[model samples]
Target: EDKVVQSPLSLVVHEGDTVTLNCSYEVTNFRSLLWYKQEKKAPTFLFMLTSSGIEKKSGRLSSILDKKELFSILNITATQTGDSAVYLCGAGGTSYGKLTFGQGTILTVHP
Candidate 1:
């Protein structure tokens, strides 16, 4: 059974505090790992790490993949209240964009 698990299902951080979100998985044939931020209806893509691109960074957010370890991590630096959102991790297989997701980590940034 393919599955993804994230730690500290919920977190509270003060402004400017750095936070790290962890995602671990077990799958049949892992093709890639995807990170998303969920604020409303659906999650929005943040990073997609494959064998070719194992690390991705954008602004205050960054993520890395470990194919051998079968897990990934998301790091947020200089957090802000606006950064409060649910973080989701998904595993992508060879079937196009087909992904199995984790329950999600709810992050709250307090000002």
Candidate 2:
């Protein structure tokens, strides 16, 4: 069975603040770590990290996986009010394309 856990279930921040979200997991056969952002609709894929140490990044979001520690971290810099949403972390197991997701972390960014 694969399980994922995310810390700081919720957060409140102001615009331009930087935040770091944590995720740890345990899986039968780990394949990859995935990050997603959800507002009202379906979760939008943010990043997929398979290799340790290498970071995947977008304009204001970045993530990295540490395979040995079975953990991953998502960093959001200069957050905007529009960035407020639920952040999700998922663990990919040997079952291709199937992911086990953790309880989402709700982020509230104020202007």
Q: For this target, which candidate reaches the highest TM-score against the unseen true structure?
A: 2
Per-residue lDDT tens digits of candidate 2, residues 1-111?
Answer: 678999989999999999999999998888988899999999999999999999999999999999999999999999999999999999987886799999989999999
What is each predicted model's overall lDDT from 0 to 1? 0.89, 0.93
Count of steric clashes across candidates, in order: 0, 0
Tens digits of per-residue lDDT for model 1, 1-111: 789999879999999999999999897778888899989778898998886435688999999988878889999999999889999999977776788999999999999
Error of 1 at 108 (Å): 0.2
Q: Which regions of candidate 1 are displaced past 4 Å? A: none
- In candidate 2, which residue pairs clash? none
TM-score computed on alpha carbons, candidate 1:
0.94
**Least accurate stretch of 10 residues (summed lDDT) in model 2?**
90-99
Candidate 2 residue 44 C-alpha distance from true site, Å: 0.6
Provide the global lDDT of candidate 1 against the true structure: 0.89
